[model samples]
Every structure is written in C-alpha cells, then in structure tokens.
Target: MWKMELKLTDKLAIERTRLANERTFLAYFRSAIVFLSSGFAIIKLEMLREVIWIGYALIVIGPILFFIGLFRMLYVKKRIKKSYQNDPD
Candidate 1:
C-alpha cells in the first residue's frame, strides 16, 4: 500500500501570521488617522497661512503609510509562504 505524503505547510502557523499582519496594518491605519486628524485640526484653527505646511505633511503621510503597510503585509505573507514550502519536516 502506498502512503500519501502531506506537506508541512498543511499545518503551518498561518493563523498567527495573519493575526500579526492584521495588527500591523491596524497600527499603521491608526497612525494615518491621527495624522489626518491633526491636519484637519490645523485647518480648522484658522492658521492656514502659517500651519499649511503641517497640513500638507498630514495629507501625504496617511495615504503613504497605508500603501506601505499594505505592500509590506503582502511581502511578509509571500515570505511566510516560501518558508512554509521549504520546511524540513
């Protein structure tokens, strides 16, 4: 009788990795929100002439971080997949 060979990835720590990715994403998201909020606060303070510089920074920082977070998460997932496939077991 022939025995079927199953891969180690079939039991890899996928759930943990996913959770970690989510946590990291959320952290970035929170930072983005805070930056955007700061921008809005500055805009609302009637100091647009003087504080406009900070507003521009906030406008760019949030989205930039969000995209970076998304890309990094995908990269990490790919790396984990590779590790799983190269398991010694």
Candidate 2:
C-alpha cells in the first residue's frame, strides 16, 4: 500500500474537513431525532388527532433523513480518503 506524506497545513485542512463532516452528520441526526420524537408525540397526543397524517409523514421522513445523512457522510469521507491517497503533493 502506498502512503502520502502530508504537510502540516494539509493535515490540518483534512482534520477540519473531517470535523465539519462530523458536525453535519450530527445535525442530521439531531433533525432525525427531533422529527421522530415529534411524530411520536403528535401521534400519541390527544389534541393532534386530526393531523395524524402529518405525524406519519414525519415518521417516514425521519429515517430517510438519517439514511441520507449517513450516506452523504460516508461518501464525503471516501472522497477525502481517495484524494489524500492519490495526492501528488
């Protein structure tokens, strides 16, 4: 296996990129949790009986959002790894 030698700046930049990716993933996870919780709340609460469909929609969307986020994070991480491995610098 070939390894790339990274400069301090390049290493720092990559670290930042990784952190940013993690933050984005966390945001997505948070949103998914919120949606799922809200959906459950709406479904269980007696007051929101009329809008049950909205609850179901949110429930469906929550997992989709989570998977999308997971996929994106993995894709970006893969791209970053690829770039670094192929780096000529």
Across residues 4-88, which tens digit of lDDT does each residue of candidate 1 receive? Answer: 4545565556657768988998898888888888877777787476878898789789889888888988898778767665444
Clashes of each: 0, 0
**Segments of candidate 2 deviating more than 4 angstroms:** 1-4, 86-89
lDDT of candidate 2 at residue 37, scale 0 to 100 = 92
C-alpha lDDT score of every prediction, in listed order? 0.76, 0.91
Lowest lDDT block of 10, candidate 2: 80-89
lDDT of 2: 0.91
